[model samples]
Target: MTNKKQRLASVDALRGFDMFWIIGGEALFAPLLALTGWSLFAFGHEQMQHSQWHGFRFYDLIFPLFIFLSGVTLGIANKSLQGLPLENRWPVYRKAIKRLLILIGLGIVYNHGWGSGIPADLSEIRYASVLARIGFAWFFAAMIVWHFGPRAQYAIAAAILLGYWLLQVGFGPLTPADSVNSWLDQCCLPGITYLNRPYDPEGLLSTLPSIVNALVGVFAGRWLRQKAGQHTNILVGLAAGGLACLLVGLLWHRVYPINKELWTGSFVLITSACSLLLLALFYLLVDRWQWRYFNYFFAVIGCNAILVYLGTSLVNWQYSSNSLFGGIAAALPDAAGTLVIACGVLLLQWLVLRWLYRREIFISP
Candidate 1:
């Protein structure tokens, strides 16, 4: 392979597109629909929010897609590191491990930063979370791509997906009801399950399928790196991958069901498919046509995705809005106050990212 690196605009644009949902779905879009009395749009927004359990939704795609994009980026990163000395690889490995630790720490702190309401004796600080999973999955996937060739990496991904399915079906703990399908939801996962609190959103067993999401993106990255006729190949590969995933996911749903909480195989397949489709669309628009204006907004957030996520978690935007921007929003309606606050949060993060970009500072993990 040539040493030359290709910067894919679509990847950054897709990352920004995914971050848009994470930043603020309700504040950005819901209020407008409420004013128009458009019930369908309102309903769509509601559906975009996560389902309780046992079904897929537009909102559920956000995290998986983010992880998938991370995998794509990892492939690019590995490609850039080609022919480096053994000594250099150690620093990269250390950085990956550090990122994993940071993500896990953040997840724990985010959950219990104020101290859990539950007693310390009974409190089981959840070790798994979306960020934590992403960190682990990205680190491992990157390692595989870096150490092994792309073809072997693809084989490993297949093994994970297929093996996870069989493991869940065969060795998974049986539920009280003795149904094969119920194993994943009731028995396979580790955590305190009761009438009120149930399975951990980020659990141990589900991480298996979650790894596949990242690996699929690794494949996409490999395809993008191919020399001959890159645009047509990427577009075709993305379309086929997305459609195949949608179909396989629907079929798997018959048995496994698309549960985000469990991170079921079907959910992985479907979400990965959606991610591929979205990536293709972004690539076509941004890379092919050079549609660069709208991208800057998302690129700001994309550049500092983890910072924005942590900011939202730590800082109470509601309080900020009430204190800082309250006077201006007061002149407007009730929904207008919420909208202004939403925009303010976005602007706040954007300015911070812009400053960081100017300073040549970037935070990963």
Candidate 2:
């Protein structure tokens, strides 16, 4: 097996790659398109926006991809847990439970507004959030990985995807307001519902399918762990699996429709396919080829991902960026000015993360 520490650098880099787009990479596109008038930047700018109601976009993959990577980490980290006595794993459970609770609480805070002080009415809070979904999905998926064998885990994932499909068909239409997912959110979920009134995209029932997304990551992670050091074999396996998932997802979409908001089974499969392919590319370039120099930029962000994510929401990095680089940005042309601002914001965020990375103070959950 490869050195244990080295195995995770690519994973961190991939995660940073995903988060980069979310924080500011996508914003960079608009300015690029304006400056160069390049169709490529235009295409990227379009992909950056989330699709409305149905269908998919590159932006839609961001949240689920993060959840999926969490699972990948779970699988690799928990491999040794499988050999440990059940009682010996309590510390692990404690740590996971702590992480889950923190993510859920942070998710609520994320929804409620971080800097803008919480609303007076407790009912005003939107309890369901992106972080909460990650917490629930990762925690449950981790439980499964700890308890079940790979074959059983595979069976469980298939059952989850198929079962969620059946539930949607039996309960409600896929429409935003009428779907079972929306209904559950409106009725059972407390606080304010954002995105879709009466339905949060990261709401209740949709979380089920998300678990499968994380499980898919676990599957990929385990595969990578088992085939460590066999670069050719690992590459072929991930590519084949990703392609197979894409095919299955497309075929399923004919019936189910790939809806990210609903967290539909088809959506899970398709996103998981994308996640796998991305992971493969990151693995090949960063891990196999040892491309540390370029990968380090992302790895810094990945190391302190949760900090930067929550920090962006809570702290005003944009204000700081403007303070430091606004004059330089203002001197440039309109499009170039916007690009400079975006780069400044990203650079500020990266600097904080780089500081933590240098001090080895990586934070998560």
Highest lDDT against the true fold, candidate: 2
Model 2 Cα lDDT, one tens digit per residue, 256-286: 9999888899899999999999999998888
lDDT of 1: 0.73
lDDT of 1 at 303: 74
Model 1, residue 209: distance off in Å is 1.1
Candidate 2: worst-modelled 10 consecutive residues by lDDT: 111-120
Candidate 1, poorest ten consecutive residues by summed lDDT: 1-10
Clashes of each: 0, 0
Which stretches of candidate 1 lie above 4 Å from their native place? 1-8, 79-89, 113-123, 171-196, 227-229
Give the local distance difference test score of model 2: 0.86
| Deviation (Å) of 156 in candidate 2 | 0.7
**TM-scores of all predicted structures:** 0.85, 0.95
